[model samples]
Target: MKFNNKIVIVTGGARGIGASIVQHFINAGAIVHILDREFPDSFDVGGNDSVFRASGDVTNSDDVKSFIKGVVTKSGRIDSLVNNAGIIRDNMIWKMDESDFDAVIDVNLKGPWLMCKEIAPIMREQNNGRIVNIASRSWLGSAGQSNYSSSKGGIVSLTRVLALELGKNNITVNAVAPGLIDTPMTRSLPPEVFKKLENTIPTKKAGHPEDIAHAVAFLASDESKFINGQVIHVDGGKSIGANLH
Candidate 1:
């Protein structure tokens, strides 16, 4: 029980990587609070009575604040924050609309920005905390994803800057850049496109949300106290070389 007695907040925890992260933390004996617009179907997570659900939009300041306050009211303190809420709007820069870019940025970038703005003070007072931002490998560059890539790239930048500013307070900020992971979003892709994506990964397969969760668990735990301000790539070596058939 690495996270025993800890309280963690996970945004977008209803599905995908966020859900996996929530379950992992709960399994490790941490009380997990999920901030998301919708709740997931009932699933047993360690049977420890460690799961808390808060329904709200991460992009809305009021919603974010309320969710945090609710968590604090129940848990007294937050030991870790995982900014995992994100959205994708695929299109080239020339074709992308201002609203589309803003929507993606609002949720993917500004959402976490607001979370930190509200929660960092609590962490500062506690004199120790961990914040893990979920970014994407597409931040390096991606075709037809100007909005998503830019939003994720901004997360990478935010992670490093926050780590620097918060380190003195014993708060470590880090980002996890995941490659292709099988999720509801990717499941919608055409079979041909999905196959191409798999062929490109060095592992010849897409990643799983659990893979990213494992990385996050380590960063959120005491073992990674020395690791900070890093944008860890959870990709399966796909970032090293473009998948070419």
Candidate 2:
């Protein structure tokens, strides 16, 4: 777990699962660069010299380019890129506005795609790198989440294609499909709805952000070099049978 001297960038690192991933890498001794629209107002990212924060929207290609450039300027190299920045605009397919679908896709899928487009060349030149995309089990099928589901599905497909395209350059690309993680996003869910969702899980427990972070950390590690083009589920078995209820 020691990432001594490693340089990593995590998009959406200001909150929730992304924050957990940043903290994990920072604790492991990596020079962590975080890209977020803004740091969460409540928490503090102080006291860590190895942690660098960049404020910008991931959906903007220019912002992503500048952030990656800044990371290279400060860290001297890019060892890993966690494409964790995303958003959800949920609604039934028939009820969903085109804008909702486009927004979700722009942030969730296009944002990561753009990050990869910018950072992959750096990795290729160095001949070593890891890219982990944060996706969701909702991609399987979720009512009232047409926009969100489509975006995540796109992530899975993008991960596989990137793996094939990047492996030749000694870069590994993978993804984590998380489900029911306890985070600011889920905290906004209505109590009754959240409870019912939990009740359906075999684990009967919502996942922590760290649950997903651990998977991303592993994928980013050298130990997982051969495990590319795969989407590992961190859903407490939810993908298997957590919804049988």
On lDDT, the leading prediction is 1
Please write out the lDDT profile of model 2 over residues 103-178, one tens digit for every residue: 9999999999999999989999999999999999898888999889989999999999999999998899999999
Candidate 2: worst-modelled 10 consecutive residues by lDDT: 39-48
- What would the TM-score be for candidate 1 when compared with the true structure? 0.96
Candidate 2 clashes between residue pairs 3 or more apart in a chain or in different chains: none
Model 1: which ten-residue window has the lowest total lDDT? 39-48
Tell me the deviation in Å of residue 56 in model 2. Answer: 0.5
Candidate 1 lDDT, 31-113, residue by residue in tens:
99999888657744555579988789999999999999999999999999999988887877888899999999999999999
lDDT score, residue 11, model 1?
Answer: 95
